[model samples]
Target: MPFVNIKVSAPEPTKEQKKQIIAEVTDTLVRTLGKDPAAVLVMIETLEAESIGKSGLSLEDLRSKK
Candidate 1:
């Protein structure tokens, strides 16, 4: 079995987008690693902007600067 974990900060993905992500990831693993589609697991974790930081700035702060 192959496990794939993805983390995204804030503004969670829509249901359709998430499904596309899972499908694409599974196809990639199947084609590249020869993993069975049924055996491939994809997990997406959406974290709050406050929970993720970079360069001493939280994701929320960083996005605000944009």
Candidate 2:
């Protein structure tokens, strides 16, 4: 079994995007490691932009710069 955990800052992915992510990740594990799709676990976690930072600036701040 393969477990994949993905974390993103704010503005979570849409349902269709999440579904695609799960399917693609599962397929990758199946193809590369011979893992069963049924046994693969994919988790997506979203955090507030304020909680995630880069270069000493929060993601929310970075977004504001854009």
Candidate 3:
């Protein structure tokens, strides 16, 4: 089994985008690693912007500056 974890800062991905992501990732694994589609697991995790920091600033704060 192949497990893939994708983490992104929220507002999170839309349902359609998530579906596309899963499908594309599965296809990639199947094509590149000869993995079974049924055995590939893709998990998407969204973290709060406030919880993620970069360059000494929280993602929330960084976005607010834009």
Better of 2 and 3 by lDDT: 3
Count of clashes, each model: 0, 0, 0
The number of clashing residue pairs in model 1 is 0
Runs off by more than 4 Å, candidate 2: none
lDDT of 2 by residue, 1-66 (tens): 678999987699999999999999999999999998899999999999999989999999999999
Kindly indicate the candidate among 2 and 3 with the higher TM-score: 3
Q: Which 10 residues in a row give candidate 2 its minimum summed lDDT? A: 1-10
Query: Model 3: residues >4 Å from true position, as ranges?
Result: none
Question: Best by lDDT, which number?
Answer: 3
Full-model lDDT, candidate 3: 0.98
Q: Which regions of candidate 1 fall more than 4 Å away from where they truly are?
A: none
| TM-score, prediction 2 | 0.92
Of the two candidates 1 and 3, the one with more favorable lDDT, higher being better, is 3
**How high is each candidate's TM-score?**
0.95, 0.92, 0.93
Task: Score residue 53 of candidate 3 by CA lDDT.
Answer: 99
lDDT tens per residue, model 1, 5-48? 99998789999999999999999999999998999999999999
